[model samples]
Target chain A: MTENKAFCSRCGVEVEPHKATCPLCGTSIQQTEEEEPTSYVKKYPDEPAVKTEKTGRTAKQKRIFIWEVVSVTLLIPLLITLFVDLIVNKTVTWSLYPISSLILAWFLISTPLLFPNILPLLYIGETLPPAIFLLVIDKIEDGQINWFLDVGLPIEAVVAVIAAIVIIGSIKIKNKGMNIAAFILFGAGLICLGIDFIVLKHTRGTFGVSWSLYVLTSTAVIGGFLLYLHYRLMKNTKLQRKLQI
Target chain B: MNSSNFPTKKTDEESNQNHIQKAPKKDWFRLDNAATVFSFVTSTRIPCMFRFYANLKKPINVAILQQALENIIDRFPYYKVNLRNGLFWSYWETNPGMPVVIEETKYPCQKMPIRKKGIFPFRVRAYYNRISVEFHHSITDGTGALIFLKSLVGEYLTLIGVVVNDWQDVFRPNQEPHYEEYEDAFKKNYQKNLPGPPRVSKAFHLPFKLEPKGVFHLTIGIMPIKQILNKSKELDVTLTEYLVAVYLEALQDILFSLPLRKQKRLLKPIRLQVPVNLRRFFSSKTMRNFSLYVTPYIDPRLGHFSFDEILKQVYHYMRVEVSDRYISQQIARNVRGELHPLIRLTPLFIKRLFGKIIYNGQGEFLYSGVITNLGKVSLPEPLNKEVENIQFLSAQSPVTKTGCAVNSYGEKLYINFGRIIKEAHVEKLFFRKLVKDGIKVRIETN
Candidate 1:
């Protein structure tokens, strides 16, 4: 049999015959013709046999399982509460609010976790459940469809619009932090003003912007400052230093 | 769900609109047969990837390498696309952003960072004196990726004032991305009118344990070219056939020693999947996936097979399978399945389910292991002088558990064996077998 090539003792692997130093770690090594092989031959170490568990779940699947377990666990309590309340009251009573709110919470949490890609659709999908749940709670409590169609629906619509604006803006402008801030502040200001108008119409019988003026003034000022900062950062060297962090 | 408010899937159109500032019509494209399998089979657990690396004489400049990577991206727009969901087939759409480049890590060919959708399907990493490019097999085959890596290095050398000429041998930067480069070569050359090749049954597999973190073991053996060539000549077979025969011998040795019942289950056939680059047989220069495989095997049920017998068998099968008619028939087999009327009508989710099943149940079971020979990698003179060695490593298959890739440069041939199992039984036996043949073997590990 021919001679085995020289190996780097530091690396515990063979190196090129011409190498004076290890290619991986620049350490000096010397090999002679009669050197014994330092590496293993027929057998590998028995301590670390590769893990052979075939049916182990992946990280994402594990996360999904945990979420499923949490949902099921929460469902049991909700079901117990509903059964107890229905049996005692003989009608849908105080349990209606908690059940509707729990379902609304589930939709909000699960939509972002599950269907994260299509945000616009998710924003719309998330809005309908909460608005409908509010209507359900309202009908059970007062036996009337009064404030839901007027105030709750409008507020949800505005919130959905603001969510869409933020999602689209963040997706479009990758590095424009100030632009995203300004867009969110501006959308939030408009949404606040719209909500105030809807509430004022319900309370005072007319569309008059009451508490919204203060929100509009503060949000407009902050939004304007953010826009100015964004433009100034685009033109100055100081922005680069801040961005490097 | 309200259909009016929810936007239609406009990925291609939206990408074009942002780049050109005009609303363009949707430009969805279908996944080719080779690419289709990868789309559904890829998870964080089992990503299909292969990596190639070049060792330089001096340390690599990260800045210049990153610049080279960015410059080369415009030329490979076929690889610059993002995956999208389609009605019956997953597709690719234009990626209007640059591909990511980073420094290499301790892990060489790990599962590609494909968890995030819309990320590029390839990555360029540099560390120490080595520059490695790993590609998702969905994006391109070895030949195509090798061309890209060579061109990127060539561009880097030129930028650093190395006296390099004739990038004409490889794909040069600033060349317009051609439609032909991305064309599904299998589809274009498919003989729909001809009959398909004979179907394959389940093949043998190794009952090896795998690493928990999905980590793989890579052992690269460097041997002199002349020693192997002389042995091949003496045996009257090609170098690949000689190597395949040796690999077969190692498997047979393991097979006969196993308990009788276990042997009966695992000893159906010892098949080696030799990926045949189609560029040699066909005249197409497309950089997309265009390679096919021929499984050359030995049925243990046919009694004992000596090394020489295995060599002759591999030599004959390679000769028959590498021919144009047989390769075309194989292509017809794959194309016919895709062109099936019922398959065409299947929904995307259902198709993905079938694709996953086919990948795990069919793709993995049909081959015991894979051996891919990149032939030889040569650079222009000054650059070649700067580069010391080249290496290629493929991810270990979940089923096969090990794979072998070969790359040669100068007088050195590098055989990289990647396996998920901790024990290096096959590699140790193969190298020992080489040493027994009077060939000097130098081994490296990662």
Candidate 2:
């Protein structure tokens, strides 16, 4: 006599090779189309057990492709704009213009739209350490006029980049809504700005209306008005009249 | 005190329900479920000057009126018992021999200068205009209340000098159509087209309390019997349908402070809750609450629907509801969950709780308004002439509200409304419209 068949893992029913799901309970039993004969025979009546490797591979490929495409699309434009002035015009050495343009675009426009929250980090990226580096390089490099970027900009630049990573990486723990990443990014940027202000307090003043506050107020007012209009229009519609519960 | 003698009518409604060895269903006030019984005794002290309505030119003598009230008390033996379970009922005790209790107290009816709450259900009321009624929501509704009002009016008419012979012709007690039986029986008896029960969809409650400028009692008389019956034919609907359609249309125009076409659509699905009598559900008068209801929904978007269109909808729904097939199906469906033994074994408290879930949760008996057509009034043969009209106005807003009470003796229809929402010009506007449509409506105030 033939040996009794083993139950499918997902549906708890006897496996059949041709069927996609158990006839009794309708649970999907297969995750892949093909398997080795030995693995299939050993597991059940000639039917392979479900596999999860396919799903993992596809997900990894998708994420890598998206990250690559988005980074190139974003960085390429700003890099070209900055270097267009430096390398092409040959006025600034080594075309440091490309890096500075990316930083500015990321801080003001792109970061706000992509994730309005941590946008403050851009100012910190552009300031603070560069100011200190200018003093240090001036003393060390025989007080050369061009030594400012070599010292000051790098420290400010490093802190801004690290802060963005810290905020965006922390958001990985939360499986939330789409705009959540943006909110976290904006928050991190804001904190970096605060740190930069503390560092540069002696030289510069953080003015009256902060960038974050201005953006939030305008957005809220527009959204509120739109919602109010929708409410008034829908209040007396036929759909509302038909509602029983 | 125990040998029972009560009139009985054997109908399919009384079929298969007597599992308890037929020991004449216990007196309503002495039922097995006694925990829920409540009692209120109201002592009325009045100069009885309102007796003018009771006895016009040759007023009913005070001694005679008292005797008449006692006679009614004696005839309805169920009215004599205290509030008890199973056989739930309520009544006022009338006695000419006992001393009368008359004291004046202020009442809060919207506007009517001053009017005393009557001695019975009118006085010791447990009803608030909004939210919930104190009694079990399952027991009685606006429709059943309509019947009760008509009966009270009939009783009042008898107290006067007039006799009530034609009351039966004018008012016929209709048992709730037991739809459990086959269609053959229904077709044979209830020929009118009827609709299914009403379902309330949207209820817009305004926080503003009514502030009436003035209130007056005006009597609306039905056109000549021939005229109304003829118009009813031309409209191809029942007299009730035509009247409601007219009023609903009028309310659409009047309820709003401003006039706008879109505003009319806001009042769509004007639901009307009509109560059906369940007297024949079982063969026992000992039951206090024996009525069920259905609602008919009308779309107000028809703007100004023709009298015929409104009448057809109303008449058809009423017919369908009262039809044998519809009634039986409803009964079978309502009874489907309960097996015989489970119904009997279920404790009263549990039953009441279940009732709350069913009535408040599932039942949509009250429509935008309720029109309780007490059908025909049945009174003793002699009291016809002394009575001009009988009007029963259900609560208007808060509490158990909606629907106008209508009672017709012949050519006269008594229309009653709460003082809060009643517009004075409507009485005239209503009559003018009716007369224009060849249906004469007369109004009188005394």
Candidate 3:
């Protein structure tokens, strides 16, 4: 059996059958007559000439398809409600609010899903639907863009701008803390104060913050406490381990 | 049954039994000059991969293939090494165990993360009778890769009770690996006095738009080598030179067809890179990357070149550039840079930055596209009788939207055109031209 075995000319190691070159040195393998013979037959039938075409949807297209399915699912319930409201009231009375709000809600939810990669654009883009919904409601029942222009647009613009800033800042910084949550809380509080001032000024001759002061005080205390906890967590390794799964 | 569906336990135990005690100890080796450029540029989307598939006579037995893979792991230890990031250059550390064999997926050559912890640089996938190995370019050149594939196939056939002739010529299990197989041949053959190869100003690019999803498509056109050889004899050039001439002629048509203004802006000389295996030139037996490329250029500005004219020019250029001294100068330029004191001292991050710059400014831009011919693959009589066909496909990158690779087995020459672009016009043109010259081509795509 040992005499029947052949070896590689370059490496002096026994070579396997059917290899054209030595696997170790890559030299052209030398052939010899010494080998055991046995019966080996082809058992499986030949494969037909075939090619698999790439017809499946891309990842981006798949996401868009899911969005369409969700949108259609939501739209069906709103349509049923609209018919019920018409049968009861016999006029476009209560359905107007639900119809307008549902459309606004769908737009806000889908816009983020539609352009998920552009974070800043999503923050700013979500503001349009709410303002448009308000204007549409004002036109259907009464005929005024006054509420939209004075309060709706301004409030939406301020929030969208602040949200965009926070998102863009978070992406730029590597070491994120709980500062982002605190920043958003302070921004929302400031927006609320501005909203109170706007309402007071519109109804009366003077502008004064009434409801927003209490809201601001609460948010400030909570945000300050969160900042303290975040710093403590960063320093305490044992506690960090205990908090995580 | 689907290819991924296999009997798991039997295969696992057989492979574990064969390879557990004999796994080679850890070994480390430096990357050659040609391989040094690959690590910095590798990414998930654009992995440096070259793959080949063999259509067997019978359906693949995964249990036997896995066991065969484990049996032969000790023979090709250089390929079994994991890439390690060094301070100055990336290196390879011998992985302690055998690489796992997996089923083929929808995508081919999806990134192999050798740089990441505990990852291998090559993949072996089986789909029925088709077994494909996609290797990172850093480990081996085409010749070395072909040898590895042949050895794997040889082992697979033997495990299934196939009578393989000339058994000693192929890689056998339990053979101690040769130390010289890991030597950096480029460093051994480098000369200090040689001059750098001439600089290329600009190379013409294909004007087609890239595919939307960036999916690479491979089209295999199999034809009888006799017809190609006859044509080459008529043209009085080698088969590789004749094929490259046809490729250049196709690019020439695209160049001249553009409108005058667009032509002036985009029309540059077409430089076709042909990779020459250095094992033939230098006497080293190392299997790691030992190859350099020769760029044969055609200046469209000079005048319209007929097919015959292009053939003559390619033949002449290949002859001159493939010589011993000319090839040495090409290797010298790379070895000289590696030997520089400041270059050796630079950190890995800085070296990566320089690698990127060099790849963009000097590496790929010097040529329009690459066409690698592995020449011919030969197996012993009995084993070769059971095989039907073999196909090779080159990897496509951002800079190169398409590339060509050729390998011949038995009577058929498989010309694989790999492209990332949306249009298959160049591929269509290439086949149509071959048919026009009286060669029948059988086309398959994925």
Candidate 4:
């Protein structure tokens, strides 16, 4: 009953409504739609260039803000626990702090999407408070590197590991990166850990330092594995090609 | 029975009877209506689609979906690994060796497209009772996914049944998953990757506590057509544009009744991530998952936007995303690259943390839903007669609490919604208005 004069884009053939493509000649043409234009851009880590440019946004600026917020907020509880650890060294074992710090950072900083609005507050709260504490701690402690060898460096290692995995993963998954800082961070943490294990354990006791070999061995294994991966990455040149964002 | 075994209808006219088959390509990657209605794009723990098959029988067997999924996953390895000692040509640019399973989600989707790991924002899931999937905006558009789903359904049918003719010319024969047809992917000339920074936003969109009112079993039958461009023009949009607007209007009415604000701030536009086909980009149709996304954000202003306006926007947006040159270049590059190069090397623990890094706060607008219209499905009539109806439903995981799905066959459109938002007002408003607007609306409960 309806006079359908729609023609297929692939092949110039008139087709009726709801007809997928031309019948006389098979051609893939678009279905007709007269809908409103979408001004909203979907949030994707790796947005297409046209999409990114259309929105007048860059992945770099956003990352700096997010990292500034998240990384800072994540530093808070660590400082708090550190602040708490200094006063009550006899009461609480120092070793437990890094584990707790890891927990707090992973749950608090890592997965803020689970808790929506409180996220920004969590960021601001994490930032200003910690900056003040670090200032005070710097004045109180003697310039000796004991804290660095003990609670301080371990906590840093945990933070670095968490940051690296998250940053690298985000870059790979979301398609934005400059996690060169994160790489240095995690790499430094790993190096620190190796140093702390070898030197601190030897300094602490002759017998206990034997366990450092195990740590060294594990690090070598991980390093070797990374080498294998780097080789594979070189072998597999697929990751180099980026989709037109 | 094989392709040769399909029944030759007495005439092309008889075969092309409003066969209720889904049109192909455009809107093939479109998703359900509920996917559009909500503001949050959902993700899952990755194991939901996996079900240990117990009694693998005829209908509702987990094996059908599982085997199909597994078969698809298994097919790419031969291409990924340079097995033939370089005797077989290797396209190193868009190699199949890229990790399809992301580190954190390990979601088994989208190995081809160089984007996020999981088909987050949207994906497809197959269950024992049903199969559902939600894909992000990076994959194919709705129309494209629909065509693929039909192909999947046809392949499923082929797996289950032996096609035959009235004269018994078609005979029983085992169908082998011949991946040989796809072996030459790397040798293709159209190889290149679009270079762009990842799109992340500063604004945060929160999920309005909504649940699936009910799961609607839209028994969509396919019409005999190579693709469904005809109906789209009649509807005045691309196939996805039309269906999405239909559902969006339906959702606006429903959300309007929910005692909510007049103008909400969290208008995380309903992002329509449709899959675009790269077959035109490919030298052959033998490759697996040769699709990408044409994502468009729908303004959830409800009744403010007309169907005509929405279509105009969605159609052009999609066209630009999946333009012929873009599709072919992506395919060429993908075929050239190697698979799982970095990811295969990364430890699982580190990989789990990867999603958090990239997705944590890269973008502002939250994705509302994903629609993949696999396009029209024209099975050999002999095979079509046996199918009561083929449905594609993703695992309705509790991750995001709401999702949408769509599959259409010619005149009949299936807008199956999977959500936990217990609001019927949206469904009621949609069904009523659809019929009022002359769309033959049908409702089914399964």
Candidate 5:
């Protein structure tokens, strides 16, 4: 053991007996021909025990199992509807509506259950299913895509945009008390104006606004008052004391 | 509740049966001022945990250690609670489930599942001759943890037929915990109208990439206490002062060694967050977080500093900043923030978001590194003789990249560095400097 003493020429610190490489600098320690190699006893065990808690099922496994069960449950209704449609009509006819509606329902419910934490996918899940359902209904009724594009898609886009702003704004804002309510009020006003514009252009063949003007005016006043209360009055501690509820 | 509420004596069979029984319903505690922040910032990458262990002369008997843990756990009831979320703050609820002793892991301070219902905030593990306890910072500071470790070691020794007559500072298993032990010392000692400590500028951080999540690197350097003590004495400074200067000097070396352009870009002060245990200054036995930090720094942009200059700066800074007046200012600031009407009215989820922002902006971001010294550990009589050495390992910080914990047992001082980055530059420079300063260091890594 005494002959196994070795030092790293680079670091000048004595390593453990018979270590080929320095633990600090990873420099190779040269061994002498006359010295015998010695096995170093480790202070701590090298292999880590896999840290796991004993439970009946893990959270991820449970989620996956629930997703599988829901998928199978939805599959039963879809298979039954298609079988009934085939048995009734020689080819495919009115079964298209139920089939499409069931498929849309399955997509809408399953996206949130399976990928609940993914934000982008959730937004798509919220917007895409309704858009597809509207398009299918429009085609089955009029045999052309007229109201779906002009009315349904535009309204869905407006709602999605406004909802995205409110959700993302609430999450990113530092002090989330009255400011979140203000954001929602502002979003509500924007959605009203958007709906009025789209419906006027689709129905009257002219882009104009009417009743939504009254709704927008009321929401803007309330939203503006809330913003003023949050940024101005709420910041004054003396005022807060006097106005304590 | 006082000592009378706890049953002191039980038969061996009864004690064994009571090991896993439901904890009696006790009044829950609000998370201490310092602990509230730890709860917000704890994650898989930064566990916000620390470990204190004693190495025995012989290999550990697992069954005896487990029995010893089960016997003594009821004494430290404050540590046996689980973290519970509240409307405006998080509190500790007494957990009915028992905390079991398990085998030690290769990594020292892995994350504890404190957010889970019924899980305790601390764990005890045994590996070979070493018995270790890892505590979440939300539960207690080093002083509190050391007492628990001493009590556990004492009970373990007594079970294995060792007579420990000197029970000086160690809490025996049969003793009921004092009411004072459950007090939040920071709030108790907080002064109402003191000025808060000045805000610090952002210090230079290590530019190394972070390691994969859950991978922590620990390197321990064991040296003779007398040698380092003599060196500090020769320099006319305390052990902590000497070590902090060495750390700053190492950072300076790494700073100046970079390319000129990079060095210019990274010309910030090198500061270390040194935790000062408040129980020393304030008279309290609260087993929760009761410590704050004083940052001793050297601005490299001023000029190149010799080791003597660095040592003088650290010595003076620590002398002035670690006093009762200065420490009280920090406590005042923390308690005041918690007491503010706006902050108190905000919900816990909002506070958590604000905590993340503050932790990123002002927490570890303001310090280059941390060095926590538990000072010297002393156990009673024959138990001390059976214990070979004691080690303290600080938690891994993803932002700071490295942290150092120092403690001494018997003749040896163990300086353990816990890192979460792939680079070992800080550890290499620190130990190599000590070796150059005429201290013999034996290196151990995990």
Candidate 6:
């Protein structure tokens, strides 16, 4: 079978037999007498005309739906406790604890679901909830936040700062490998020292050190060894040559 | 399924069976140097896949094609593996399942769901009169894919009662695969301590709006091979150099057509990434990604360049860059990067996170566009008569927006442009220039 062809009068290039206009310049093609449109087969098949049905919920929609369900589920217990406390004691006295805990739970769960790609928001979600929960408990028990300020917030701040350093350092490092472990180890050592300092100050009303020194020494040694291996031993050209694939 | 009906001799079949049973199965393979980047950067937008197809004179028979695929798959044992994730890097594990032949999709080079369990890195697809193989770049490059396609078409033709006597480059189904065919040639030829090629400045990108995800536009321009070759001969340059010069001129036209302020703002070098097949330089038979690219650029800031000037630049640039010494420097750089202790020790997850940044910074950011030519394709005697033409389609890149693949079969030279952008300015300009230069072009789009 012979294939029929058409050329664009303006462009002087052959167009597909089925096309009425040139694909390049959109100029109309003058069909010849011998050209039969239906005689030629398309080189590639056309896209299916029937659009496939959208049957399932999108990922974002599903995440939002789950968050709504969790919110409602958490809300039910909070509402029940609030009503019971009001009915028995004529105020939101005992319900505050459950209410605060439920709010903290919702914040933690929704943080990942809503701001999953936003790292700073997720970090805030992780660090802020416990501090708020502890402050609320401190106020509820003693009508002040002295312990929350001296021990709770300080310890949380130390952990958050160290965790941030490790995470950001890991991302920023040019060649990320054993050095990440070293960063984590060093961060852990700092956290131990921070915890010891805060607890000692809060308990004994003086600044001093304790068991954390041993922990700090051990972590520093390991962390230093990892650093040495990563920077010194691994970077050696001779070693790399020996290990080359 | 009849043994006597097949091409493999009875003795060869017995030996192949024995080899399979006696050989220790390599359950896993490390990603080659070129493939390591693809493994990390490949996603739905950038599938990192390419397609090579052959158009036969007759409609394809699905059952016979399936049999042909099964018969020939063992000869390409490396391609039969599936992608698996390891601690330090991604690997290819032996996949025991057979790749089923499926009907061709409306689109070409769609993302292979390789991360899914049991999914092979390459797929065989058949359409009305065409049979295609889409391979993830991790599995092979264009040369390897072309070899695989030729073999498959040969096998298919043979099953359909055509005698294929010329199996010079074609891997027959009955033949045993050589160990060298599966070796990583990049690692094998790497020379340490050599300086890498000079760093390239960021090149100009097409100012076209990206199409939606999963949308790839293909425009193919077909012309007579003799006409283009004669034109290239008149210009005193090879066909590749002629085509690249035309491509560069097209980009220059687009850049100058824009508003002056916009042109100044986008006044970067127009560098085309032309991939060089390294097997020609180094005597290696490995069927993996053993190719590097030479970026022939024209700086718009210098001055307006005529077509002749661009051709001169591309011709000389290609001459100097497509040499063994220059290519070895590239291989050295790539192998060195892969062998660095920190890079080797870095966990796969962390590498994946940084891979996109690295790819953007060091990969596509350095080139304006990509044009890969597979040159002329020739099949053996009787099989050649049954085949009409062959087409190569490169994968769509979100950054570069357009890539061109060129190959010739018989008398027809097929230039396919794969784009992920809404505009077809590059395709239009490139083809119109060819038509204007007295070479007839037939256009088809998908």
Q: Choose the strongest candidate by DockQ.
A: 6
lDDT of each: 0.72, 0.38, 0.72, 0.39, 0.81, 0.83
True contacts kept of each: 0.12, 0.00, 0.00, 0.00, 0.21, 0.30
Candidate 5 CAPRI category: incorrect
lDDT of 5 by residue, B1-446 (tens): 01112232233444455545523435477788889999998877669999989989998999999999889988888988988876567878778888888877667788888889988899998888999999999898888888888889989999999986557667777665666678888889989999998988899888888776667788888889999999999999999999999999988888898889988998999999999888778877677888898899999999999999999999999888889999899999999988765566556876775676577788888889999887877776778889998788888787788989998888998999989887788888998888888998887777
Q: Estimate TM-scores for all models.
A: 0.64, 0.41, 0.62, 0.46, 0.69, 0.73
lDDT of 4 by residue, B1-446 (tens): 01221232333344345144412211111111111111122222211221111111233444565455444432222222211101111112222333232211212222222123322233334433333343432222333233334444444556677443331211111222233223333334434454332452332122454332222112122232323445567766766676666555554444344435633644435554454444444444332234445556555654456666766766777667666665554444343332223432333233324423333333213344445564433344555554444444333333233344555443444454444333333344444454455444434322
lDDT at residue A85 of model 4 (Cα atoms): 74
Q: Ranking by TM-score, best first?
A: 6, 5, 1, 3, 4, 2
DockQ of 1: 0.06
Among the numbered candidates, top lDDT falls to: 6
Clashes in candidate 5: how many?
A: 0
- Ten consecutive residues with minimal summed lDDT in candidate 1 chain B? B1-10
User: For candidate 4, what is the DockQ-based docking class?
Assistant: incorrect
TM-score of chain B of 3: 0.92
| Candidate 3 chain A worst ten-residue window by lDDT | A236-245
Best first by lDDT, ranked: 6, 5, 1, 3, 4, 2
Per-residue lDDT of model 1, residues A87-184, tens digit only: 99987688877777777777766774555335466776688788788788778868988788888888888888787766566555544436556888
lDDT of 2 by residue, B114-215 (tens): 112222212211111110111221123232333333343445455553454444312223322122211111222332334433345653222123322222
Per-chain TM-score of candidate 1, chain B: 0.91
Please identify which of the two predictions, 1 or 5, would achieve the higher TM-score against the true structure: 5
Clashing residue pairs, backbone N/CA/C < 3 A, model 5: none
lDDT of 6 by residue, A180-229 (tens): 77999999999999999999999998898798999999999999998888
Cα DockQ of the candidate 3 complex: 0.01
Q: Which ranges of candidate 4 are over 4 A from the true structure?
A: A1-245, B1-193, B197-208, B211-236, B252-262, B280-288, B298-303, B324-347, B354-365, B396-403, B409-411
Which has the better TM-score: candidate 5, or candidate 6? 6
Which of candidates 1 and 2 is the stronger one according to lDDT?
A: 1
DockQ comparison, 3 vs 6, better candidate? 6
